[model samples]
Target chain A: MTVQLQRSATVAGPVRRVRRSKHRPIWEEQPTIAGYVGKTVALTLIVLAVLYPLYTIVLTSISTQATINAAGGLVTVPGEITFAAYRQILSGGIVTRATLVSIGITAVGTLLSTTVSVLCAYGLSRPNSFAHRPILFLLLATMFFGAGMIPTYLLVSHLGLIDSYWALILPTAVSAFNVLIVRNFFMGIDQAITDAARIDGAGEWRVLGQIVLPMSKAVTAVVALFYGVGYWNAFFNAMLYINDNSKWPLQLVLRSYVLQGVTLPGSGVGQVDVASGAVTGLPVKMAVVVMAIVPVLIVYPFVQRHFTKGVIFGAIKG
Target chain B: MSKQVADAAPARPAGTAQRGTADGGPGGRRRRPVTGTAHRRTSASVPVRKVSMWAQIKRDRSLLLMTVPVIVLLAVFAYVPMAGNIIAWQDYSPYVGIVDSPFVAWDNFERVFTNPLFLNAVKNTLLITAFQLVFFFPIPIALALLLNSVITPAIRTTIQSIVYLPHFFSWVIVVTVFQQIFGGASQLHRILAGHGVHFDLMTDPDTFLILITSQAVWKDAGWGIIIFLAALSTVDPALYEAAVVDGASRRRRTWHVTLPALRPVIILLLILRLGDALTVGFEQLILQRGAVGPGAAEVIDTYVYYQGVIAGDWSFAAAAGLVKGVVSMLLVLGANKLAHVFGEAGVYQRA
Candidate 1:
């Protein structure tokens, strides 16, 4: 009976593959001409809806002042493109300073948070460890409940974290959610491997550093990307805690310049200068927006492949 | 809502639970399982003995050391602020601080419930949330189904990547993009004006609800499709073959097979969404609140920020925030209970 079952299981694999390759599934029948047209139009419209605004933003950012004036707003067609906007923003102005601040925050914050998260996750994954259950419960409890904005702000103030970089990096650091994801990934590692290492007289540190972390690069990268993007994109914390405009991160600068249309004094494109046609503020604003987004865009493709795996493993089975 | 569900479901220690059985008891005793030849040899000669909790803790010092910073960080950041929520009961002043603030039992809550602006914020939040639930919920599912029907994997992946790009963008970028396209000074506005027509959907109070909901959909719908596509990939192709062999039509097969396969995930997401119905995009709304005015834009979260942080009504805002938090918790628990009735592992297993 076992032999028969094995033979059938072996047979079924190829049979399924052959059926899938040789014939179209009945549910996926060839559509009628009109149906095909409808689907094509629907998909194209969806794609355009997502892409057109982004296209316009890029175009407007690169277009010359004359082109922007001719277009009367955001330029669509790329005519007489110039790198003036990019140059203006990157020329040691408020935008450049803010970009540096954002980079520092994202880099430092992601590293610190990822390290803390991995350590905690590793410790918590060992359920047999002392006080593991209570610690896990304590961490998980933060997931559901939070002190309101007032109290949290009060706490930050009381701790004298106001106007400090530590306020941004610390209060929001060690996301319980990310820790849980990392812990889940650590737990999914084969027990026998760790057991073997322990038997070899490897300390928990050696086992974690040498064995577990090497195996968890994918999830670790994904978690770090999550934290990195979060730190990169955060503006509300700066708005709340940092009273000094000079300490503002890129996202906060983007918010003020693009959304609120506020041009800083030291920025090359001052409001009066822009109004007097030295430069149209639109291109500069778009440049700042692009600057805020480019880092994530550059990193996203490398991390995109891991998103489905990370999200599924972190989310569904949790 | 997806975030809320993801946050609600704590990782189950399934491996530890399995190991618990082998270890004999769940007491605070540390069992050094026979892992290597040396350990096994040592254990065979030496009998097991009960170790005190302190000794067990000492034995696990390295692990405990690893955990100390995390515990301290969470204590300082999370637990302390949670303790600070007591300001809801006290007439909190930044000058007097938490300890010295005069106790004004339930007065803040009374003001929160009775305030007209607060009521308006609640109404607007619920309205936007309802719109999102009705219009934005099915988009990702529909998109996933559409993408699934494509025969070419390359085309599907390209489309998926393009759609998922917006999810990474900051709300600031998203709002700017929307404003650039639909604001009063936009190209669309110029074109309409050239033709003797004027329209500004971005700041239009009458249609602000639609505007924000569309922003949410455009920002997140592609990312939402990821979970659905993951669910779709798990559906057995053989089931489709079986239905085809039984002479099922395309629509009928979808009804019989695909819908049922997707039902659990859909219901799970829906329940999670319902739990977060009160929290309708604070940052997005706050950014635009200046344009459309508070009457059109205030939500519970923004209300808390405006009242507490900006206006110095600390106790009142805390009271409102406390209510929002409690209601949200109750909503999640109630939804999880309902999921249990349907035999789904909603967030956590019943204890």
Candidate 2:
């Protein structure tokens, strides 16, 4: 019984053992006190390097105008805080319109891309399917070689997709990379089940819709989030294809406001706006940045758990 | 948890029976003949059997129907633009279109090679690529190594999640965040002003390249560590135990075991990065171009955009873009060959 426990402890490894005790592996000697202090300092500094900027951005966004002015731009310390910046941005205006536009684009784009990707990926996943090799070769070729920017722009313009939301969606509609990842996933499914469905007189569509997709919810969710975040954060396509300012997505608005320091017509109007002596003060600008980032932040935890699997499927397989 | 089990299921053929069939074990009776032929070959192992064209189409009719939209989308969006690259050799006018445009054989290529601005863009791109390869490449490996040493799963996951979060953010947000903290009128500047120290690092042209590369590292270093961590996890734990039994120290074990395990992944990523060297962040540089001026920020991608789309020098821009595309493809092939020379499977096996 003691031997079995020792074997189990070894099998669980140092990581698991660290939770219960100060277990050091045989390969590792216990470090001096100075070494421990040095490691703690290094880790703390690294964590601070990452978290400080993010904290400042969030803090600046919430602080009142008077507090910001007293703090001389961004308030590091907690003061009279308010959600006024969030209120203003969410209030019916350009920021609000851009947010809605981004949401719409993300939704529509994710649905279309995910549907098309599923079809392509499923088709490609079947080795015995018609023209599978040639079709796959064609898809793989796109991963290496691309039609450069000018000709692509010319094609979009020639097709009259310029100034349209379709320009954003269609130009980058199906990421061959995402398709390959999904294909890798589909290939991993138990062939027995799919074959069983086929033996039961189920057609290809039925097998895909009923058996394969139902089993692939995790990957499909992960892939959808990838597409959604992609569409939400895309500003270059908007910068290129979208000629009208009113049609700009949230990222583009964030770019113009925060990066270029362009104050929107209705972005600032409150107690803070008058007190900061700037049209779009630090808080409002940071608020727009936070707004642009919030969707991604909300979805990240769910998708974070799946990225290792998703990335391994794409990277290691290929 | 189900996904993990499902993912692991494909690796062990003997474990398939335990996973059970859709209609239960008795369902295998009907599936025996079908699975005999079909299940013999896993997806990536064997090429599909060659059936008659009509039979093949009939067998895969629904799948074919499903793939039609994707094929159409790629043809229209990807292939058609490749054909539109013909305009590189023409004096292209949007009004005249490709067919009617006056052919200017070799003129655009000659112009691109001769133009000082294009040359400058190439120089800047190569410099930025070199800087990133030197500074940005090893960071994630180091971070992964650090995280690997920490034997706490909860701390590792939390730190990893924090770092990886930035990768999901668009370049617009990244650049904006940097500008907010470090721009000319930024909070940093305001703080420095109170102390009577004038500072404006954002708009400084001399340091723009470093600034942009730092931004790239901040955004992607955490994400990059995932692959390295995956590689590290694959290293055998018994190797360390054997080394320990042989009286190897931690440093010696790391040197002998850990680094060697990471070598293949490192080389693979290096080859891929070399292939993508010319494309040094178009959106990141373009968004900041106004602040630091174009001379410092224009890489090949942004150069092509500015010369082609923004300035409307269609044929000339197309010429430069075609050169970049062709060179990039060649670089990829060349790097893959180099990887093979070093005994690593780069992107794909050579055919």
Model 1 over residues A1-318: C-alpha lDDT tens digits?
A: 346445544545365523232223433445566766787898899889889988888888898878888887888888989988899889997889999999999999999999999998998888577778888889877877776678889889888988898888988897888888889989999999998987776777888999999999889998999999889988898899999988999988888877887767756443535453423577888888889889999999999888888877887767
Ten-residue region with minimum lDDT total, candidate 2 chain A: A17-26
lDDT string for model 2 (B53-119, tens) is: 3334434556666777788789888999999999999999999989999999999999999999999
Which stretches of model 2 miss by more than 4 angstroms? A1-27, A269-280, B1-50, B191-197
Clashes of each: 0, 0
- Who wins the lDDT comparison? 1
Runs in model 1 deviating more than 4 A are A1-28, A268-279, B1-52
Q: What is the lDDT of residue B68 in candidate 2?
A: 72
Q: Across residues A126-147, which tens digit of lDDT does each residue of candidate 2 receive? A: 8776678888887888878889
Q: Local distance difference test, per candidate?
A: 0.81, 0.80
lDDT of 2 at B165: 83
Q: Which residue pairs overlap in candidate 2's backbone?
A: none
TM-score versus the correct structure, for each prediction: 0.88, 0.88
List TM-scores of chain B, every candidate. Answer: 0.84, 0.84
Candidate 1 residue pairs that clash: none
